[model samples]
Target: MSILATTRTVARHRRLSRLELAAYIAQLEGQNTALIAGNTALAAQLDQAANDISGLSEDLRVARGENLRLDAALTATNARLANATSVGSLPQHVSTQPVPIVQRFESGPVLRAGASPLAAVTAPGKRGDVDKTQPLPVVTTT
Candidate 1:
């Protein structure tokens, strides 16, 4: 072909190639913008998750400390109860002799029928017999 016609054809081809390259570059830029937005959103979510984890960790620490305090208080209470029980035991010496059942009136003490004033009071046995004698312990509160 002629030289001018060949040069014009090469120029037209180069212009078309540059237009296609510019359109591709625009598409790549749009895709890059979308990727940057998505990365920012992901970073925000990661920051929120980290804050939540930190709050939960603090709550767990407080709960563990409260649990330890409650455990110690319970242990101390149990020890106090054990000591009180050991120290507040009943007296060992109790009167084995039964006391007389005397009903005192405004005037003086009276004895019922079938009961003597000098006779010792006896409690009934488990088998319905009145022969069992239970020891009575005198209690005095100061």
Candidate 2:
């Protein structure tokens, strides 16, 4: 009878301890559920950031390719202009005009078609042809 009373007391104490442990486990399970929810939200944000990064990388690649094309076109145009605008260094095989074009400046008189400005052929406001047989006065400015 004494042993049976001691066994019942211990069994009741064990049952109470099991109930306390179960409550503690339930609290930990609730915390785990909240932490899992937070982890899911963080994963979604990371995925969105990765997607934006990929889009920017593709745009940079396209811009670089366009810049390279424009650089190549500029180099070609410079070469073509350098070839066309040569003053005296043209190729020997490529035939060009040999006659030199002389540009005269206006200083004293306006003469045209082989008429010399040193010899006065016609006066101003007179409609007359150039006279080659004339000896004009020589004015010297030392």
Candidate 3:
């Protein structure tokens, strides 16, 4: 071909390549802008998650302290109860005398025979013809 025709052809090819390059650059710029916006949203979400974690950490610390305080209070209460029970219990060597047995019936409470107001009574089957080897059956009035 002649040099002039080749030059015109090269120029046209260059122009078309420049247009294609410009369109590709525009598409790349759009993708870059979308990436920047997505990165900004991700950063905001990360900051929110960090703030929530911080608040929850503080709450856990406070709850642990309260649990410790409650444990100490419970320990002190148990000790005090132990002391009070030990001091309030019945003392030994009060009396060895047996008290009278008062049997309760449907009508009212009645003193058993041979059981005085201040004296003691023998075993249930001792004075009766009941069996001495076998255990007596329990009786319920009410």
Off by over 4 Å in 1: 1-16, 77-142
Model 3 quality (TM-score): 0.45
Which stretches of candidate 3 lie above 4 Å from their native place?
1-16, 79-142
Q: Which residue segments of model 2 deviate by more than 4 Å?
A: 1-31, 82-130, 133-142
For all candidates, the clash counts are 0, 0, 0
Candidate 1, residue 130: the lDDT equals 52
- The model with the greater lDDT, 1 or 2, is 2
What would the per-residue lDDT of candidate 1 be over residues 1-142, giving only the tens digit for each residue? 8999999999887774767989999999999999999999999999999999999999999999999999999999999888778845646675444444331232344445445443444433445545423233343322
lDDT of each: 0.72, 0.74, 0.72
Deviation in Å, model 1, residue 60 alpha carbon:
1.9
TM-score of each: 0.42, 0.40, 0.45
The candidate maximizing TM-score is: 3
Question: Which 10 consecutive positions of candidate 1 have the poorest summed lDDT?
Answer: 133-142
Best by lDDT: 2
Instruction: Give me candidate 1's TM-score against the actual structure.
Output: 0.42
Ranking by lDDT: 2, 3, 1
Put down candidate 2 lDDT per residue, 37-106, tens digits, no spaces. 9999999999999999999999999999999999999999998898799777778876564433232232
The per-residue C-alpha lDDT of model 3 at residue 119 equals 45
